[model samples]
Target: MTGICIQATHRRGGFDLDVQAGFSDGRVTAILGGSGAGKSTLLRLVAGLESLKTGRIHVGGRTWADAAAGLHLPPQKRSVGYVFQDYALFDHMSVAGNIAFGIKGSRKERGREASRWCERMHLDGLAERTPDTLSGGQRQRVALARALAPDPDILLLDEPFSAIDTHLKRKLTDDLKDVLRDRPRAVLMVTHALEEARTVADDIAVMAGGRVMRLGTASDVTDDPRAHEVAVLTGWRNLLAVGWMSGNRMGGAWGAVDLDHPAPVDAAWIGIRPERIRIESQPGAGLPAIIKSVRDFGPVREAECVLGCGATLTVHKAWDTPLPAPGTRVGLVLPGEHVRPLTEGRAMAAVDRCDARGRQARA
Candidate 1:
């Protein structure tokens, strides 16, 4: 029942944001989007950095911004903590100094608060060190500790791990995840990194063109959605134009293939992850394709094949599998259940169909 609720409409510079979204407390919600998708703008609106043009923005039972009632709480007035994109640490401030900046109390009390967060963030010995001397990971932890030191009910993190190197980023992400798990406050972290979202977030909101196009749990968004839009963001390699066929089948690049369910009305295309594609060695086991290209990438070998329909699609095989020479004809094992029809049965229609199919399948 307690959460960050938002319904707002803000427009600027050819970008229009009109979304009504909610994120429960005691969870981390990652807003995933591409550059210029208004991810930061939404965060700013929640943080009170930007005024709400219309609708309400509420956090943890308190109304932060309600344009209908002309109520707008300034960022400083609201109980919120923010970790900026670059960490935003003061060059002159030591780690402890940065942490104590947002804490309200006597010097001794603030020092105690800072010390508490330092310990939680695994920054005991580095308290006296300035930002310039610390590594990117340390600086990030210090910034996080500083924001969280105040014990704000709502926390906003703007791509906190984007600047760090790969090795340090993973380590820092694990540390940050632990820090967040220990605390059950409402959190919203915005990032363009899919792996980070998959690793860190409990919930995900897929954003595009200044709005959340889809909202679901991490698994729902990543592993199961299967729609072309969500699939594209989460590693699907092929999204080919197609036409619906009879008997719950689709006609696309590789010709007519069966579907697990009825074809969605108005479907414009079909989606398939390259990894889901299987290359068969036999002559007549499956759809015919000829090897066209190959690339070796350690764990998996990627090969593109030209289908009889004259369309090229990529396929993945385990590194141990023998590679087919160029022009060698191969059969494709594209499962019906795994192939996702795109732009079909979206909105409430999809939900209704899903529920009905779920019941029918269970029955």
Candidate 2:
């Protein structure tokens, strides 16, 4: 295979992971999901840190793991670079020594390579410092530099930004993006942050409940996540149960929306992104609803509204827009093109409203 192909079933404790995904060279594929969704375990499976109960992993036409062939490569035997969530750097060694440990050359040559990475990772003067003396972002850079020092064929990152401060996350993410731009290798990153996955990855694999829920380009997956679990993970804040009401119309907890065409037969929920919802003050403008509350979030304002069915919907609007006071009557307009139909499944229970934390609550 020209790219990294993985078809693996792994069991660890109470969790079972069965995923099939492919990642192309020179591209970053983010395995995105919430905690306990099996994102990190999938990364470990690729790195040989976890054994596969069944299936195969082929990287660059070489079989790294194959249950059928009874072949499983050790971590050191596979050409892979891994940056753990903790940025596992040697506290006893200087930054230069830690990075040089991975290089296979002699002392002089290793020193020269380590110096090059220090400059590349913007640690030019800090190379002599120990990891304990460095900041979170600095330690992260050192971990990445050390991983890349060996020139591995694959790069694996597990929540690369979890340890960094909120103020420094964007800058560090941008720095990592610049580092991966021209590198010709398959990079698999595991993260729960949707924005980080969208910002740093060329492709995204949505992992949830120990399976790959969706896989495609970042835009494709984020723009039109058709599955219920996929939609919720990708920022679809309002998911209401719907039932056939009339021609071209479907009634749900949030009232009804008139679609251009008939609703899908299998659609059990109507999903709307918080930013896609529009509130109109006119009595008969659209679906009837009452403004419950509004909060300012700097760039945007979040408003909570209640429908006639007693269900609530969250709407995000530009901060500059006129803010509606609490208890005011308003109409919700779910644009046909912006509304998404979510399929029904055994694991997908009907969600009537979003909780205070902006998560769906099953009624």
Candidate 3:
């Protein structure tokens, strides 16, 4: 299947976007990063909403941009469906009217297409409602239907679930996965939530400082050494900056630890999910820590522990598990193989070699 290939540079305000990335067809490719990572800029470039200073963009083997040749396609002619973060429905139009607005066809044909999308989006009974009358989820569904009704070659979503309430957000996420499942066009979705990316994307691209740091299949990107930084950005709580202390082992301020594979001394960083930390009543090979605080999160409990050397760690456990009271002493056990060594530095230069290998696998 033909996919999207983009390599471009653009300058906006104080930021500069120097991005080169490819998206696959028939799969959800999630663009993940922090606030200023240029996720939206990448989407705009692909959609022809932003002008390119250099480079080219191709969708399904068709050239939409070529700066050197002075060829630039306008947004309306790009054949791309865009769903904005705010759900951008027309306040003046009914749900059905909104979906049928820009579609090119006879009135009856447009009505049929609108009705089909409304049914697919579970909005059959709400066809006559205006934007103000629908719930947040319903409005988002309407916006999606409007974007897809035109039958574009590619789909672009910019934080599509960011505006909903927490409870409804989960349901919308599941609903979106189902909607995008059988779509024939390529889809690129931008979000900072790692769990959301995991749920909806087959491949992932992690961007920072207007450049893609890593891009590959979800599992491969998440398993990469550089993924430690991505995990931290995604809200991972416990990341230990450890390095090789001996053969097949590493050492952090906490203690000496073993690894499934040896990593370069300069490139090693150990990471352990908070849930993997086990608190033992007896002395063990793990680090000795003092309980600092305990907080409850629905069905789970998180304990903050301070090691003797002053490093803080969060341990996650079931609410029913026996937990140490604040001020009690405890021990921490981290699995050996969980440690990952990443390349040094955060600059784009450091990611070049690693990203080259990553791009090959993804392609």
Candidate 4:
């Protein structure tokens, strides 16, 4: 099956974007970044809603834009499907009508295509309902169905789950994943939520400053040495400044810890997901800390601790786990493998290191 490849330049506000990306067929590639990272701008460029200053876009082996060659395809000419964040359904159209709107065929053929999409999206029972009467998740399903009914070669989703409630987001994400599985189309989704990206994407692109800072499989990018910024953006809780390092052992302001493997020198930050941290009643080859607070976040409990050296860390435990009360003394154990060494300096510097290393490894 064919996929999508884009190298585009566009201007938005005072920011200018120079982005190049490729989406593989039958896979979900998530565009992950912080706010104002130009994710939406990239989506608009792919959808043909924004004019490109210089670049090219190819979908399913067809060139849609080639600025140097003066080839630019309009939105209608490009076989792309777009599902907006707001569920931009037509107020005058019912669920079935909306799904059938973009399909080009006889009335019977359109109706059959709409019904198939409605069934696939679980909107059969609500086919007669108008957009206003549908719940948020239902409306989102309708929007997705409408986009898919046209049978486009590429799918572009711009924060597709942003408007849904937290409780429903997971379910919708799973549903969407099931619907897109094994389909011979390139999928690009933009989301600020890291958990959402983690759940739905096979590959991830971390964007910042109007450019893609890193792009790889989820594991490759997340495990990259320069992915501290991505981890921080993904809600990683414990980021301690590194004080020193000797061989495979590292010392931070909080405490000294050992790494399972050797890391490059000049490490600036130590990243540990709070959930990976463990707390014990007594100091057991770990840092001694005083519990500062216990926060309840429904199914999980979080204990905030301050080490003797003044550095703070957090540990997540099941709500049922017996947690130490505030003011209690505890030991914070960071296993060797969980201590990720972060590269020093700005975000792009790390990306440069990662790219260089990748090239050397490939060579």
Task: Score residue 120 of candidate 2 by CA lDDT.
Answer: 90
lDDT of 4 by residue, 335-357 (tens): 98888887643444312211211
lDDT of 3 by residue, 186-239 (tens): 899999988788888888888888888787788877765364566666566777
lDDT value, residue 220 of candidate 2 = 84
Give per-model TM-scores.
0.90, 0.91, 0.90, 0.86
Error of model 1, residue 296, in angstroms: 2.6
Reference-based lDDT, each prediction: 0.79, 0.84, 0.81, 0.81
lDDT at residue 294 of model 3 (Cα atoms):
96
Q: Pick the candidate with the highest TM-score.
A: 2
Q: Which ten residues in a row have the lowest lDDT in candidate 1?
A: 353-362
* Local accuracy of candidate 2 as per-residue lDDT tens digits, 1-363: 256777779998989988766777788988889999999998888889999999888887788898878999999988889999998899999999999988997999999999999999999999899999999999999999999999998999999999999999998899999998887988998999998998899988888888888777888888877678888888777888876657667776566887777766777888888998888988898888888999989998999998888888999999888877999998889998887777764244212122322222222
Off by over 4 Å in 4: 219-225, 280-284, 344-363
Return the TM-score for candidate 3, rounded to 2 decimals. Answer: 0.90
Worst 10-residue lDDT window, candidate 4 = 354-363
Position 257, candidate 2: lDDT: 84
RMSD of 2: 7.4
